[model samples]
Target: MTTIDKHKPILVTGGTGYLASWIIKQLLDEGLSVHTTVRQKKHKTKYQHLLDAAKQSPGKLKIFEADLLIDHSFQEAMTGCELVTHTASPFKITGIKNADKELVQPALQGTRNVLFSANDSDSVKRIVLTSSIVAMVGDTIDIQNLNHGVMTEKSWNTTSSVNHQPYPYSKTLAEKEAWRIASEQNRWDLVVINPGFILGPSLSKRTDSTSISLMRQLLSGKFKMGVPDGDQAVVDVRDVAKAHILAGLTASANGRHLAAAHQKDFLAIAEVIRKKHPRYPLPEKVLPKWLFKFVGPLMGFSRKYVERNIGYDFVFDNSYIQQDLGLKFRPFETTIEDHFKQLVNDGLIPDKRS
Candidate 1:
């Protein structure tokens, strides 16, 4: 593996995303120039925050227009960069009219486009991919069949399909395609960071992210009575961003690393919020599994998903990331509190009691 030049700018795909924005901020803070790709250059409002951040740091920021499905769109931005971080992917959980067109194809083809550009770029030597834990296990119940009942980097999701759990299926296919492409070439090494449900203050005020939406739902009394007893491996957005930078810079970081910090259910997350803001109507009770199975459809959850995930614990072995990257994660309580405070401060969530 070739050592990446700190002086040269690095390429970060989907720079306006919640996770990508944090990664860009850290890169600029470190005095490293960044080349970021956006879907439209005309939408200056989307990436103005990145530019503002660059003004405060020694690093410079450049924005380029790129599309995930369009071949060679990322080539110009990737030129002269020794490392590339691919964080762009469709992440919608519901209202997906066409899973193949919306989630699966874009994710799979986006990976292809980015890696293809990396292959064409002579300066590129390593790639840090933003994969998710869904690629490791489709549902929480899948963990029960494992030897230790915990997911690791070696685990691969096999239960998800285009029809059911389409988001997880998309991630699984995308990461698998990335690894397959990386194996065919020797010029650049591939490093994948599989983070769990990411939550933290977003760099932008955008509420389009699922994390922000979920937090809003919690604070808005949508689940004041109770929430489904389903566990999700969780990680802070900042930690996931740091993992990408470390994965790109560290020579030994070649394989997949799980970046999750804690394993907690929806109700546990609500409890964390309630502890900080007692005024908010955060759910304290865990809804029964059978109740979830009955009402999950109203909330856009499939029967198969509810059957396989509700009441099951989602655990992961995150020791590899800590041992390999020397990463110290912030406590889950802090993450949840900070996230809730950000939303309230930004006026994104209603502070008044129902």
Candidate 2:
């Protein structure tokens, strides 16, 4: 069992990020002091939401500037922290002109840098890593070969490479590096929260998050024509945040815990949104696999990706998270409904019907 100090301020990297923001809020709501990192210290506009949240909570919030690739950049922020949640990593599926430079190096180096700092810090006892289900399975087709046709913590993505599915490749490599570093030391225990396609509201209005961008595309009529028949394990952002807190504080929590709530297709997600808000131009049908395969290249997806992922169903075993962390996921309808409502309220997505 690992010992954690509730009074000592906990450190959370990437505080302004979509998932990290919610994690910070949860920690503050519990009246726990939070120390978080951002890329720029002077960019208050980017992180003002966090400051505002801090004002409303009883817990104190301290902001620090740290870079993912810089060695020991996190040491100052981690000085008195017993628990560290590393959530900073690059996540992009497309517009990759150079995969090794854009995705892999940052992720691998960032993990190394953070773990190295954790090793240097005598106060740190537990580290909760924010990993993705993509690290378990590279593509939906890979699920067909699994023993029970479901992905679990035992799975490792073997098909992803720098040339194909670079985002997943980066996550897989980063997580492996974290494990390798953690195994060499006994001072701190490492717990990993591997969430599925995280979808929900954001604390910031920034449209850069992959989740936010995807949600915007869906509600903005980008998929009004049709969506591919692809299935993915979905989880709410709030539940994922709660999982991190549980992993960090729970003495018995260990190893990789998958945090997916449901497995559904794009059309199913749209249906949920359409049910709540029928005015949006949401896609009502799934595009034929062959049609997507032919036109996918034009939309930045490689032929191999379409071949391996389209028209396939991917599922994840979330029993470990529920059993270990005692997590109860929100309904998919609630996640989708809340997410669209937030976007509309924030004016991130103007009502096209208007």
Name the top lDDT candidate.
2
lDDT over C-alpha atoms for residue 184 of model 1: 100
lDDT of 1 by residue, 1-354 (tens): 558899988999999999999999999999999999999999999998899999999888999999999999999999899999999999989888999999999999999999998888999999999999999999889998886888999999999999999999999999999999999999999999999999988888899999999989988889887988867888999999999999999878769999999888888788887665688878889888788888888899988888998888878889999988888899999888889878878889876532
Clashing pairs in 2: none
Model 2 lDDT, full chain set: 0.93
After superposing candidate 1, which stretches have Cα over 4 Å from the reference? 352-354
Query: Any runs in candidate 2 off by more than 4 Å, and if so which?
Result: 352-354
Weakest ten-residue segment in model 2 by summed lDDT: 345-354
lDDT of model 1 at residue 71? 97
